[model samples]
Target: MNRTDDISNLFSRFGASADSYLEFGSQFDYKEKPLALVPATPAPEPVVDIAKPVIKHCDTPLAEAATDRVPASSPVHASQSTAPLRHLLAEVARARQAEAQARNEEALRQALPHGRPAKTRAHVIALISAKGGVGKSTLASALATALRLEGGQTLAIDLDPQNALQHHLGAEPDVAGMGNASLNGENWKPLLLAGSAGSLLLPYGAMSEDERRTLERYLDNDRYWLAGQLANMGLGENDVVILDTPPGRTAYLDQALMVADQVLVVATADAACFVTLDQTERLLSERVAMGQAPLCSYVINQFDSARQFCRDMHEVFKRRLGSSLIGVVALDHAIGEALAYGQNPLLEAMSSPACQDMLLLSDTLKTQLKSMDVAESYAS
Candidate 1:
């Protein structure tokens, strides 16, 4: 029996009609049915034509030809291009304005007079250090040399008992300095030694323990003793007197502060230096509060930027000092070499990095003096 005859027999046995199965199978046409359902692929996106037409020069009216060739969107494109040009023009205008401001500032600086008034006394600078062996004397000498080189009469007074400042100024090691003059009741002006490049040097001179004690007593007895002596020297308004004080707290430091118009504290970029500076600041705060202390700033000498520890300390100092940290002298062998040879580093190594730092310091001092003069003039 075939499968169709068996299906018809099964349907007859079940009491269902065979015509119903035939009708269900006939609903779907087998030959005409789709083999598989396939979706149509989407059409490709249309490309935008950004290429602009190039217009050539014509003998006829160019405006008429440009209107014909230009597209409707060209106006928007032109506006977009003009935005960058407008920004460039604005930048150029700002640059020109900045240049004009700078020129005006320079002109004002030039118009200001140089040096203090004749009625005003000489500007006094005191160089102090918290610790010994920090190159304070060398800096004092260099600064005086720099000022003298700028055509200002500069006098360097070595208050340190070591009398080592003269050595840096190319003076004889055994020469008697101001300390000797004070002991013998001789005028200090006669003891003033002419230094290299028209600078003046007054050494501390060799002193015995008793003589040193006597000088300290004199400074203690009179607060303005040093100031009086300086005045007797008859310094001109354009003259600058630099006092190199001994390291740490001393009567000499007090005398220097008594006569100084400005104080420059010298320190190195080290933990010990910072600790000493903290102590010094405490000592100075009382004087500053009383208005007895001179205007003070800091100088970081022998600064080595390559050392990470030094750089960290420098940042700390910057935070502590802010604008009062006025100068930094990079560590350079040239400075040591010049000192060893008993030569002024500012002149001996004029092209060295250390010399450049000295020049910057000198310039800062000059500007400060000028500002003070201007302020005084206004006050008067």
Candidate 2:
């Protein structure tokens, strides 16, 4: 028998259907079409047929395949579906940012005295002069002591490279100070020395010529260097900080002006100071924008009432400066005496005219600061 006939007889003996048996040399035809590889470019808008199943590579990860699937019959496009979610997320991020800012401001207000805001905290008074030997450092130190005695937290900072403010404050001259600490990458808080009447003194410290030049270069490059330093000192809102700068235009003076809440220009009743007023005013005008200058005033230091020339110059200053002339410090022997003895004249010689004038001047300054704070509070 033929092999196909023998296979059919075997299938019939096993009870198989006739259609199930095939001839050995006959071919079987498949009705389904073969799968082709994915084309390089797909149709812009391809319709999907769910009834037909497409075979893909077995190496494709299940997670990737699931993520890539998007039904063609979906009402919303992918971009359109995600747009509202992205906008909502952005709005939530902004709300969190605003909340964080509000918390910081509230914490600042709590840390300050008398509920003062951050803008008015730590009142900075910078003492400057048009020429050397104008008692700028002396006035700065004395003012700090006077303010401290008047029940205000006070700090005196010497920005002058001369480093003479510490001596006036009865601090040791050769001790390490701000410049030394800055050069050595040390904290300035440890350098703060005790001063007369419980005030704090920050000396410029001892520095070599090259070191001084380096510091000047730093100040010149960073306009906000001094300001940033002061902010990091953790001063109370009502605390007073007095900056003693070198006379005339300097990088130190520029930095002091950048942070000073009040500018106290020291001038002796003389031709040098008088002649330099225009130049000093011009420098100040250039440093700060118009209508935003700090509260600036003049104090005539070493005014000798006994001399007609001094009296005439004092009158000229009054005429020239008008209400900007804040006070006059008489040329009292007590001031020089206090310096020689390393004592504060306001504390040592309360009966002296200079002491009385300083007390009055400090009170006047306190009043001005109070007024400023009130105005700012109202404006805010």
Candidate 3:
């Protein structure tokens, strides 16, 4: 008479597993009963196909027909109509089996140790910007260096196709890296280069147009490809991963946001960067709504106190972003100089304003990461 009754009738009619039907959220218990057979009798004036099974028919709906007992006076017709129902039941069983296997695989993955103590997992930080030339890659490299300087294990990954991050990390331009490994269907763990700043680097590497397109297509198709790739690297809980994403919105940004524990939006002191703030907030909000990064903060890079307009823009950002403004890095020529020499500015010029600001920012980030409940972020 109701949904449970409908399921019961269907299961009984097809001899399906009542336990499997219960898994569909049905609360009622069901037992299959054999259909009542008609007594053998003589039929005159018409030839009958006795080899065919008798089928009971009624004006009631097909789902309801099997639930009601047929009257003795009702004529029994010979028909072969149940083969399709049997096929449908077989398909349902196969689907259920596949679902069960997938759940088991997921449980096993969660159970396996990740080379870290219990209640810990790597903290993934993604650096993104609305436009290019805002020094996102340089900041990513410096931040990775700063974290490592603080005596933490770190891995910096270059998600941009330009592959410029390896240069800042002191890796040769011609070295094979993540892109090459992926193209060859090989492990990316062995491709990690020892960064000059005491951290590890995963460069995007050199690839042809076809290879780039193929990798981008893969990233577009799988939203969690980056997360899966990181998982295979055997990272410990104390390890921190920094993702240097390309400027503007792309498939790479989407994949990075899917796994990032923190999202750092890089901007400069300018009218153009100001206009993009609202859109950037919306982009991060979408991911937050889907249960991603709980911390999405802003960093004002290249701040110049000497220029009144630069100072005004910094004040405006401070007022607008409030506590979300994590740090204001003073503009310094040493950043470029250090990059030219393939070294981290924080290490090259520790007394410079840019280096001091970066150290303060790194300390703030470390404090925030420690206060966060790591268990909640990586819980099964």
TM-score for each predicted model, relative to the true structure = 0.66, 0.66, 0.66
Give the range where candidate 3 is weakest over 10 consecutive residues by summed lDDT.
Answer: 111-120
| RMSD to native, candidate 1 | 24.5
Cα deviation of 260 in candidate 2 (Å)?
A: 0.5
Off by over 4 Å in 2: 1-120, 149-152, 290-292
Candidate 3, backbone clash total: 0
List pairs with backbone clashes in candidate 1.
Answer: none
Relative to the unseen true structure, what is the C-alpha lDDT of residue 280 in candidate 3, on a scale of 0 to 100? Answer: 92
lDDT, residue 35, model 1? 69
Model with the higher lDDT, candidate 2 or 3: 2
Q: What tens digits encode model 3's per-residue C-alpha lDDT throughout 162-266?
A: 999998888878778788787566676788888876768999988989889867766655565676678777777678889999988999998888888888889
The candidate scoring highest on lDDT is 2
Candidate 1: regions farther than 4 A off: 1-120, 148-152
Query: What are the per-residue Cα lDDT tens digits for candidate 2 across 1-380?
Result: 88777777877898885677544664888688778778568669866788977665567788977866856675875877666877899999999999997885676445333421234358999999878998888788888887742345788999998999988889878787888776565666667899877779999988899888867765665666677677667777778999999987899998888888899999999998999999888877875764447889889988899999999999999999999999998888888888899887878556788778777788888888888878889999
Cα lDDT listed for each candidate? 0.80, 0.81, 0.80
Question: Who is ahead in TM-score, 1 or 2?
Answer: 2
